[model samples]
Target: MTALIEIHNLSFSYTGAAPHDVFSQVSFSVAPGGVFCLLGPNGTGKSTLLKCVSNVLQGWHGAIRLDGRDISRMKPADVAMGIGYVPQNQNSAFPFLVRDIVVMGRAPHLAVFASPSTRDREIARAAMETVGILSLADRPCTTLSGGEWQLALIARALSQEPQVMILDEPTSHLDLGNQVRILRVVKSLAGTGMGIIMATHVPDHAFIVATEVAIMNRGGLSRKGAPETVITESNMRDAYGIDVKVLHVAGGVERKACFPSL
Candidate 1:
């Protein structure tokens, strides 16, 4: 199967008085229906890398292809139609209702200055339903809690119906129940043939949701493979600077969980 997203020799750095490289020579690919999880500490360029892939960041030294088409050369609308991005931090200047916020994701499919039609709204509502936030559809986004806002953003991305979804710290600010819910949604989406690339601090999430996991640090990926092969005690220590025990599930689930040694 063709890759949904492919990165070749990707590198990025902010240009200013002091140019700092975020990551260098990073390469990866997400096949259709695959969930690729990125595990790293803060400021390790996981978000930056995701942005590059989503065509939200430019001036990077690499090629990111979406379904074999170079994203840099694709039009903004084309890229938007191909990649749906859910950022870590979400903010809105206006107090739009949750449903309206989600409907904005259909912007790429609409003509300039066109309002979202009934069909667009229906898609948005379905997306909200998928994220279990349809009840909040009438609520003002500014009135929601952080976790609720995150879910709204995710619903917005889902409404886009893009081929690939890029999520940066998708479970941030979520409660335990919501976290598990979102992970389950991620896995379910992958099952439907939508490629997912997610950056998350939770290693256990990778084991739960990712088809492939990569530990990124020091400007590149240090380890990448199946969760059992990549998320080891030493790898966690190297990436997170903490000691953790990687344990298997007691049942025949073939899953691993990590806990602090302390």
Candidate 2:
């Protein structure tokens, strides 16, 4: 399969009295129709990497190519047209209708001073239906539950008609059932030829949904491979600094920390 997106020798740093580099020499590629997960402990720069790929953050050193074209040279609107981003949280400062929020995804393709056409509305409605939130179209976004709001946010992203979707901690603040629902939706989308990249701290989620896993530690990619190859006990320890025993469960593999009797 061809690579839908590629990052070569990527590095990012923050300047201060004492400069700190968040990530260095990171390189990876996502094939079309692939589900890739970035896993690590907190403060590992996983979200930072996602932001860079989505063109939310600039001034990075290295090459990012989307569909064989250099992304760094592309305009932000063009990048937004090709890539959709779902942040960790949803904060609505003002009251906006659910449909209105989702419609914002079409901004990349809209002409200045023009209203959304029937086709645009149809697309946004289809996206809302995909996430099972069509009934809430006219409701205020602030009234949604955390899980519902997250799904709506994803629907908004889908409305952009992007080929690649990047999500940051998508399962956070959700119940177990909702988490499974969201993961299933994401997995299904990837199966349909959308390149999906998700950053998650939960190993179980990565095990269930990701075909490829990239373990990040201290702002660098430590391991990248199939889930079974990269989700080993040693890699878990290196990425999370914890000793764990991986067991095969009824549904999937499970990771449990090992502790000596005191």
Candidate 3:
């Protein structure tokens, strides 16, 4: 597997915030055709690291290279062309149509002051089709449920044709069914040779879809390996402050299931 993104010694610190820096000297690489899961408690630097990889926040301490290009020196538009970033929340003012919102994702490729061409629209349409949201193309964004909104956001990112996608809690605020739906979509995307890095609170998501898992601990990524190895009892307790029984559910194949150790 080719490395799509390389993060070396990545570190960040909010100006004048307590503890100074959130995490430091964190390093990892994301390979194509794989899903890398970042799991940890809130504020442990998972979301911040995603933002750094997506180029949403700058001035970090290390280097992030996307397909061998040094991302720290790249312009925002250049980064946008290669990496699609889906933040935790979004708001729309006028209830834009789903297709229109997806088309906006082509901004990185479009010339300044130029509108989306027919080809751009075609790409957006294809992206919607890829995510199984073509039926909602004409629907108002405001009318969609939480699950639909999340899928729409993913469709927008897909429209970017990014080599790698960085998502911050894609399943957050979603119902159980929606969460499973989104995870299935993620697994399908990885199957198609795209590198995916998703920050998730649900360790089960990683256990299910991630080829590799990284658990943020004590201000950096302390555990990294196969999901089965990383999502262990001790790691879960350390990262989440909860005891979970990692169980195997016998079915079509062996699948690991986690539950609170109550």
Model 3, span 125-220: residue lDDT tens: 999998889999999998998889898999899888998988889999999999998998889888888899999988888988899999887789
Clashing pairs in 2: none
Task: Give the Cα lDDT of each candidate.
Answer: 0.89, 0.86, 0.88
Runs off by more than 4 Å, candidate 2? 16-20, 251-262
Q: Write the per-residue lDDT of candidate 2 for residues 1-262, one digit (tens) a residue.
A: 8898988988887551113389988999888789899998898899999998888888788899999999888878788888999998788999899998898889888877987888888999999999889999999988989898989999999999888999999999899999998998898889879999999878878878887999988768999998878888888877767777665665443533223122
**Number of backbone-clashing residue pairs for each candidate, in the order shown:** 0, 0, 0
For model 1, the local distance difference test gives 0.89
Off by over 4 Å in 1: 16-20, 252-254
Ranking by lDDT: 1, 3, 2
The Cα error of candidate 3 at residue 94, in Å, is 2.2
**Each candidate: RMSD to true structure?**
1.8, 2.8, 1.7
Could you tell me which residue pairs clash in candidate 3? none
Rate residue 126 of model 1 by lDDT.
97
For residues 168-235, what per-residue lDDT tens digits would candidate 1 score against the true structure? 99898889988988888888888889999999999999999998999889989889898899999999
Better of 1 and 3 by lDDT: 1
